[model samples]
Target: MQNEKIINYIKNWLDNYLVKTNLNGFVVGVSGGIDSAVTSTLCAMTKQKVLCVEMPIHQDISQVTRAQQHIAWLKSNYNNVSSVEVDLTPTFDAFKQGLPKTNSKREDLALGNSRARLRMTTLYYLAGLHNYLVVGTGNKVEDFGVGFYTKYGDGGVDLSPIADLMKSEVYSLAQTLNIIDVIQNAEPTDGLFGDSRSDEDQLGASYDELEWAMQYEGNPEELSSRQAEVLKIYKSLNSANQHKMKPIPICSIPSEFK
Candidate 1:
């Protein structure tokens, strides 16, 4: 129940995974928010060589400043850490230049997804070059319950150490670790679009209420109308985005079983 215990548990679990898999290190994308900051710190504390990448795409100064702070915090708080910043604005534009003229909706969505894929691709390249597994920053409330993350974007990673923790729990752990304010208080953002939308705002209910409805509930029919609405949004996103979480199916694997 304690935050320190949870972090220790995660650290030990990661140590075991690294030993079994024989990975030399990890690479994580830090977004200047509490989740990424805390996740990176944990990795650094585990005696892993961590490469923290800041891939900002047309972001404002505030976001960039927080990112620098994250890097500084990582240096002062822990060793065996290196930082890199690559602006993705040009990359996003180049990809868009080749696309056919469609409605703004398609263009925008495509552009956003492309940025995510680009970040993952770059991370993978770095992973291969440096022999480090990509450490994901998604938390339990984001990935499991409602599927709030971008497919192939933030969701593409080899492992997510904090995937099982709720948002509140993540913050609690950050406090225990004494993660700085720039990280702990940074307004949560996807850092893709110009405006940042809170994850819960996109979802129908608050994390606490949603967790309660999902964790301890009877039949859906027995729930109140409000509860049903929350369940509907959660299930809708989950079903629609389920494909993103799974690997591409190999349709060419011979038809013997069928």
Candidate 2:
């Protein structure tokens, strides 16, 4: 994670995609976590406009402080970083009330995913209004290789700055690139529910371990007992999140393909 090369790549990507798309800057959903911090830092380093937004739901406001910390640090560090606040509790509650009463983990996942979608939809709407692109913060530990993000929810973004970097690699790059310490150290969370439950609590294992298992022990043809479990987890994440990576459907060859 050399600082110079990291900065160069980030700048190159920003120029190639964002500049080519005629976007003024990137609008990011900063959750007061490591991934968003690093992603926002990359955008800042690129000398691009960075909109750091705090879109919280019914969860506790503990993360809001971290968002502010990220904002304060960004104000000092980045040239064009700004922030906005959007509380999504009402939208989430409206959707939750429309659903039937089923209080299960699967049901909770659905509700939480709806909230994530709401946040993403809002981000995109703002992106369109501001002539910006939505910048995604999901890292390799969460999206690639292991693939743990919600379909078309948290994974839907105009650009994913850290999609290829693993969890360990993300932290390494963040430290090398001098991201804010508070954000670099904060526990990763979706904040869909109350009190900020952890990804590991829901995933049954930490992100690094899952990535290691995917890289080393995974064998699609024949797996050992432990490897089977890893494969199962990986496949479950991939299958569940497939919609995020899919292209929107169109009518025919001339219309859609062409």
Candidate 3:
């Protein structure tokens, strides 16, 4: 399908969703990545209220700059677009200070996830005030293949517009939408670590490799060594993060108890 057709399809889908939900519009948490840029742009194309919020907690300067530029571009192109920057550094610091100090090795990962959850809270708070839905920016590989997103953190959203698109497809859409080059060319990152760690750095395999693994139906014995390793990594992550992909499990009581 043509990129423009896909763009219009997503815009129409967003419009229909807004009509059904009777919500005001969309509020996207812009992270200076291609996914967010494309997602926010698609929301903007619907000509509805789009609040692109940049919630940064000790974020790298490049990421922050690209987010600002993308938001500026959106506002300039679409009058319905608006933006806000919420510095959550102090809030995160306070939250950390309140918690008991821990020397566990998992603390780093825990704190990284804490950042995502904090941003999720901020997005929902804005969404509540404006009666807008929180638009998620996760792509197919992260959302369903390897499940690389943080549970209830980046994973928390009222709606996800691009979860069906692969990372490469997202890049294609970004190019079609004329997303700012700084963002389009920048490496994909969750930005939860408060540093310059790329998504590949965290996942050990690139999105292309993960996408290949996600759709691979060939025999494992026929695969190359690197492909086998990538498949292993993908499966490990997908299995470990099934809790994020699946619905919340509900334990049912025996009928005799009632």
Q: After superposition, how far is residue 84 of candidate 2 from its true place, in Å?
A: 0.7
Residue 133, model 1, lDDT:
88
Per-residue lDDT for 130 in model 2? 94
Local distance difference test values of all predictions, in order? 0.80, 0.79, 0.93
Q: Could you give candidate 1's per-residue lDDT for residues 1-258 as a string of tens digits?
A: 688788899998777777788978889887778788888988888887899998888776787788788888888877889988878788877887877878775666667677888889888888898988899998887788767677877888888999888888888898898888877876566676645665555565777766665575578878888888887776777688777666787778667876
User: lDDT per residue, candidate 2, 209-247, as tens digits?
Assistant: 687665874345776676677667876776775655567
Q: After superposition, how far is residue 217 of candidate 1 from its true place, in Å?
A: 1.0
How well does candidate 1 score on lDDT at residue 163? 89
lDDT of 3 by residue, 1-258 (tens): 489999999999999999999999999999899999999999999999999999999999999999999999999999999999999999999999999988899999999999999999999999999999999999998999988888988899998889999999999998899998899889989888888999999899998999999999999999999999999999999999998999999999999999
Best by TM-score: 3
What is residue 97's positional error in candidate 2, in angstroms?
Answer: 3.1
2 or 3, greater by TM-score: 3
Candidate 3 local distance difference test against the native: 0.93
